[model samples]
Target: MYTFVLPESSRLQEVSAEVSLEELQSQPLQEMIDQMFAIARGERGDTEKRVMVGLAAPQVGIQKRIIFVDTGVDIDRKNLGHLEVFINPILLKKSSAVVLGREGCFSVDPCLCGIVPRSEIVVVQALDRNGKSHTREFSGMTARIFQHEIDHLEGIRFPDRVGPDGVLHWVKEDEYPEYRKNWQQWKVLCSWSDWCAMKSGKSSV
Candidate 1:
């Protein structure tokens, strides 16, 4: 369904300073969003880096102020079972709670680590990949990823969410399986046993 995707290492387009609807109205926003969904639907590369859950227009070099996210829901493939949808995305409102979480970028390695601070929840308004407008309520990782993508539209990256002294790390994706296996062996993490068994790291559902 798409032909162009921003390379993992490409310099993402910076959101034009003070971009507004006037800018989005003039961009090929719909086409880019369609291409993003096609990439997420696994029509392209085989790596987890490319089949990720979300994207930003800036990442694809269209700096007209837009983003696309597919929270990967409804995947039959276990741990990746996140809701799949796209957001043209404008941050409507946000709660001011600092929720810190691990983040990785397709632009870099799948196994990098950075702490990103985000609202516990958000209310957003945007059009879908179809150009149909809608308002969405998001919380948890879903909210975090969406908010992160929104920042990309504004020329921000996950590391920007880190504090001045925040640290970052990089690990191999192949190692996640062993790490998760050991993590589940002793800790009674919420559904750790089931989730661990279901998630062999094959599908980023």
Candidate 2:
């Protein structure tokens, strides 16, 4: 069974231990990757169930440096791509440009969301499911997903990255009508922080 150490319940605050090159080559590693996908794909929240794109080993109570990237899968009629596994991943490069984007974590309690400033693009190097090393670049939300999962390896969560004044608001299921209505439109350009700010009369934007 796959177990996710959600926010306060898990008390998971330590950085993950790196998986060695030899460990990545082990046959058992495939089973772990499979489980990660199962856990990520099956998780649902109280709100309008968020789409899970990737997850880290630590999220599943494993300390190893393993990440499951959901590249291919159908969620709400959108095909994300093929499922990809990364072992002992490394961030080879990150563009200096940054953008504030909406982000939410399954581990976070009450799971309202917040906005975070993330690199617009990032290049990563890691061992694939076959234990083969590859380098790739990602942009937009896909890049954000990689960065979010990688942050888990370093014991960082999205909320921890929000600016001091940035706000994260909870959206109860009943609020989904309004949330869903606006999300469909604002997500194209506005960050959650900005949305919250506007709602609270903090900013005119």
Candidate 3:
């Protein structure tokens, strides 16, 4: 199983390098891609299984401009689980319109989530796994996923995109009766200091 490089790790903070067509088609690169897919599918890992929609090379300690995203398209035109692989991807354009949505990361604590602002639409050019170059436009959730993964290549994380007024929430595993009754009222109930303490205790455990 592959271990994800978490936040604060130097590997996760370095910009990734572009790859050549020859390198993309190499055996080792193919195996790395396969392993990434397995981790995304929850087919590998000793921890609790959690399926991921997208993954980047840097998240797994490979400093290469590569990412695979499950576009949620159908297999037989009516199903799901279609994945699009991007190699040496470059963001060409972003729409003026933007949206805010909650996001989580595999390299970050699973309980941590934060609202992030992202372009509503984006155009990206990239080489596919087969080394074919193509440009595509993505919008909505798919666009958000692409932007998030691309940021990883630039050594950026979702938390870094959160605006000054934005807040990061650490959700508790146990159910809270008060929170369940009125979630909106409890949005800021958990303090950042409390989360820090919880995280410190978890690491010791």
Candidate 4:
């Protein structure tokens, strides 16, 4: 029964604390996940408009190196969509190739969305929920999601990645497919003032 920590909010800006194996199997970890899911799923009326693919412990006011990824599961308690939990995650390797994708976050500045560049592929190593370690590779949108949550663990936000003029508004597909065709130009003219008024208390989808 807790809410997400907003931008410039209660959460401190620092790398999250590493979770020892003992603490991973205890109640504190379970409680932390509970709060994260509550916010991720909008169960506490604090959810974002966009579908949340993953969430980190720091966003839930817990500065621990823990994160959950949605892999299409049910009844997982804290993060229903959170099919997997990673503890003390470490990036083993990342593809040199990168791509620009429209990215958004639950902890970004109000009323703003941006097209941030992201790695095309990433291989990470971490401890699973059962405290077992595993190495996995992720690509496409899934890779993007993992990177975003990992950034939280390192005290990084989506806005911090925006280019000099990369801020954009959430353009709907049916309404503005043209925006996609004219990517760079659209971002330049995507005026922050226009979206500024649209800022809600939390980040956009």
Candidate number achieving the greatest lDDT relative to the actual structure? 3
TM-score of each model, in listed order = 0.65, 0.78, 0.79, 0.73
Colliding residue pairs in candidate 1: 72-82, 73-82, 73-83, 73-84, 80-204, 80-205, 81-205
Q: What's every prediction's RMSD, in angstroms?
A: 9.6, 6.9, 5.3, 6.4
Per-residue error (Å), model 3, residue 171: 1.8
> Which residue pairs clash within candidate 4?
none
Worst 10-residue lDDT window for candidate 2 reads 71-80
Taking the tens digit of each residue's C-alpha lDDT, what string does model 2 give over 95-170? 9999877666666543356667899899989987777789999887777878988988887778667755665556
Q: Kindly provide the TM-score of model 4 when superposed on the true structure, using C-alpha atoms.
A: 0.73
Candidate numbers, best lDDT first, in rank order? 3, 2, 4, 1
lDDT of 4 by residue, 1-205 (tens): 6567766563535789999888888997777766666666553232223356677888778889988776542221223344467889888888889987766566664334577788988898999767899999987776777887898899877756664465665554342335434545554344554433323333243
Q: Which 10-residue window in model 4 sums to the lowest lDDT? A: 73-82
Q: What C-alpha lDDT does candidate 4 achieve relative to the native structure?
A: 0.67
Better of 1 and 4 by lDDT: 4
Per-candidate local distance difference test: 0.55, 0.69, 0.72, 0.67
Q: If both were scored by lDDT, which would come out higher, candidate 1 or candidate 3?
A: 3
Ranking by TM-score: 3, 2, 4, 1
Candidate 3 lDDT tens digits, 113-156 = 66778999999999988899999998877788899999999988
Between prediction 3 and prediction 4, which has the larger lDDT? 3
Among the numbered candidates, top TM-score falls to: 3
